[model samples]
Structure formats: C-alpha cells, structure tokens
Target: MSPPPAESGYSLVWSDDFSGAAGSLPNQSKWNIVSSGPNSGNQEVQHYTQSNSNSSLSGSGMLHITPQHNNGQWTSARLECKSSFQCPAGHRLLLQAELRSGTFPANQQSGIWPAFWALGNDIRNGNNVSWPQCGEWDIFENAHGADFSLGTLHYGRGGTDHLSKGSARQTFQVESFHTWAVKVNRSPSNWQDETLEWWLDGNKFFQVKGSDVGDGELWGRVAHKGFFPILNVAVGSNFPGGGQPDDKTTTGLGSGLQVKYVAAYKSN
Candidate 1:
C-alpha cells in the first residue's frame, strides 16, 4: 500500500480523484449510480438519475452531483462505492472529502440536503439485509441552508425503532469549500468497544462509542461489519423541510454538491 497522506496518520486504502475530463462519468468499476426512484422513506423530492448530466467529472478535478428541474421534474444523482471499497472491523477506517454547494436564497436552503455517508455493505448483493438494520454512518450532512454540518449514526431493528447517536455540528455554510471527515475504530476482540470521531475543516469535534448509542446490541452488530461509501444530494426531506420540494423551492440553476476529492484510509 502507498504511504499514508502526510495530513492523516492512516495508510491510504481507496480514493476517487475525479480526474476524468469534463462531462465524463465516474469510473464504472468503482461506483454504481443508483437509478431507483423509490420513496427511499425520506419523502425526498428529487428523482435520482443515472445520466452523466446529473453526476459527472470536471476538468477541475472535482465530481459534481447536480440537482436540476428538468421538464418540470426534479432530478439528481446518487453514487455508491459498494463494489470497490469496504471498511472492516478491527481497523481504524477514515473517510475524508472536500466539498461545497451552490447558494440557497433565504429560507430556501432548507430545500437542499447533501450528504457524504456510508452503510453496511451486506445491505446489497442479495444479502437481503435492510436499512437501519444494516446500519448508517453519516460522515457529513448539510440541511436546508443551515450554516452547520452534522454527523450521525443510525442502527436498529427497524427504521421506526432505530437507535442513533453522534450528532456533532460544525458552523459552516454550504457555499464555501470545507473538509469533512470521520474515523471509526472497532476493538479487535470486542465489537462493543468501538469509537467514532467526527471532524470538520480538520478540527475534531466529537467522539462516540458503541455504548454511547441507545442500544448496545444493535450498535455492536454495526461495528463488527463492513461498510461502503455513498454520495448523494437530496431535496426536501424531513430534515431540510417538512414537505417535498417543488420548482419554486429547488435551486434553479446553480444548485448541486461539488466534491473535490474522496479518500479512505486504514490505520497501520
């Protein structure tokens, strides 16, 4: 493996530099564009598109996941790195990304939600494991037009009965570039002994352990398993606004998430 990046103490494991020419799609072997329009249980308004117009690479070394109102319908993109990367237990898993978003007018920011997160890899490939049960680790999430970012963990028997913890907020706007990251460490012998730390712009904010979560058993299962990365821009969820977003609420032209780079590392 290559040496660890000087800034991070872990050895680099996987990364997407988004170095393709402008208008190019992400490497097919590394990412899978989710093409489903299921309610997603989030009441999100945007229909995820598989087209490069919604998710593409730029000559500026960035990945753009833009949401647009096309033909009176809202569309966006979601990319998952299920087939390429996985963070297993007993290792310190680190994920970092530099990102920014377009400006939102007034209270309209509540209409946009962009996130960098991860979920248990078993949820896919016919494992038949459902969400919440499979676990979710939100490394970064910006809601509405709030001047802060949030990091959270979700795991439980079901969505409604889900248990979660780890809400560390950093004061920052979506229009400006920022570095967001999270490091997860699970004990080699005891899954229950796990720690998750959150960081923004290189400042460590909060840390939580498996015991910190509401349910010890549920959170323990999540700590023991492997997870994969997901990048998406959602519109009008319960987080940003109570209802679905429409033409007036959504960003007309300059709205989307711009990711400069995404990288994962493992402790030596």
Candidate 2:
C-alpha cells in the first residue's frame, strides 16, 4: 500500500494477480482483449463485453469490471496488451492500477467512463498511423462523477494534438483504492524528455514535465516503438453527463468502475 515504487528505478515486471478462474477472460498468457466497440472520442456507444457483466475474477484477490445493464444499454470493460508484455521501444514504463466501485447514475451521465491506458501497438488496421500519431497514454481517467482524475497525452492530430497536466477536485478522496500511476521517460536532453506522473494514495498528485509534448510537429520524435496496456469502461459522449443517470445518494456521486489489480513496470 505505497511501498512498491523502489525509489524511482522501477522493476515490478508485470502483475495481474486477480487470483484466477472466477469468471475467466484476462489471462490469455498475459491479456489481449479488444473485442471491438472502443474508440471513445469517435463518439461513445458502449459495447465491449467479455461477459460476467463485462469482466470478473474474484477467487479472493479481486479484479472486477461489473457495470451491468445491457440490451437497454450499458456494457463495459475492455482489456489490452497483445503479447506477453509489450512496450519495449526505448524502455521506461511503469503503469499501475486499482479502483473501487459505487457512484454513477446522475441522469446516467453519458454512460460511466472509467479507464487506465496506454496505446500505440502500431495502432493497427493497415497502420495508416492515426490517433495522436498512434500514441496515447492516459494514466487514468474518471469523467462523470468528476471529483478529479486524469493524466493525458495524445499526440499530433488525434484529439487536436493533445497534451495534459492534471490534479484537481481537491486531489483524492472518492472512497478508497487509489494507486493509479504512470511514468514514461525516453531521454536525450530534450525532445520534450517525455514525462507524466500522477499519484494520490501515495501522495504526488500531478506532473507532466518534458516541456509539454507536441503539435510542434510530432512530439518526442516519434519512434516511440509500440506501447501497450489498457483497461476500459465507457458509454456516453461529453461524459457521464450524456448518458443521464444522476441522483442516488451515498456520499454524493454514483456509478460503476470497480477494479483491484493491474501492474507493469520497467524503468531502468
């Protein structure tokens, strides 16, 4: 619970330990789920299901994606990483994950967005190279019941050439299980240095140095190789605001997005 970051050298290898067997799915050697119906910014609609209400694994360790309500609309959970453990490029990656449930339904709010990401496996489909230059790494995201959460970085021409730095909503305190992280550094003095950092349960709530990424004609010199890792839960456009589902008190905000394990490290 905040002891896993070995100073700043990283070395966890890879982890999922959601135990095993529960509802099956995520363990195809490592994980490689995509089943279609994902892309979000193209326009949300909700359609990534492995069943067991989207995802499951609870022999005791945890790992659940439960967001039920299909046919009438609402099916989530999208996993990633296509081979054993990708993201080799120039090396420098550390992605962690942990989440808790309960909150969402304020007019449905678009459709309950929840995520932890990393992309760029060539971007697929003939590889024409589209979407932030086939590179994106949103450490974590929670749009709707917004109490604060985001860590973005999308490259040239994919979302208006994005770049982000975040930490708001007072920082953290949305009902436990917080250890979302990301730290990727390429190096070479500058080429933007390639940076991003976010942590709440272990402090350090924000950072995005590296001179602010792209639009200046391909940030960080491309050649990022081909990233990986991603977990999802979506439905809605602007946010949970477009799906409609608000008003179900507990402490305030309400919806779904419950996960309890996801890890990757390799910074040396």
TM-scores for every predicted model: 0.87, 0.31
lDDT of 1 by residue, 1-268 (tens): 2222445557878887888888999777888898977365787768888898889987778888888776767788899985434446667877888888657663655567778988887687577878888888898887666677778888888657777776746677656888888877864556556787888887888777766774666765566567788899887676633456644565542567888888888777
Best by lDDT: 1
Tens digits of lDDT, candidate 2, 140-229: 777555655666656655556554444453345556667777665554445465555666565656666555654334544232455677
Off by over 4 Å in 1: 1-5, 38-40, 84-90, 106-110, 187-192, 214-217, 240-242, 250-253
Model 1 residue 245 distance off true place after TM-score fit, in angstroms:
2.5
lDDT of 1 at 220: 59
Judging by TM-score against the true structure, name the best candidate.
1
- Candidate 2, RMSD to the unseen true structure: 16.6
lDDT of 2 at 167: 49
lDDT of 2 at 249: 20
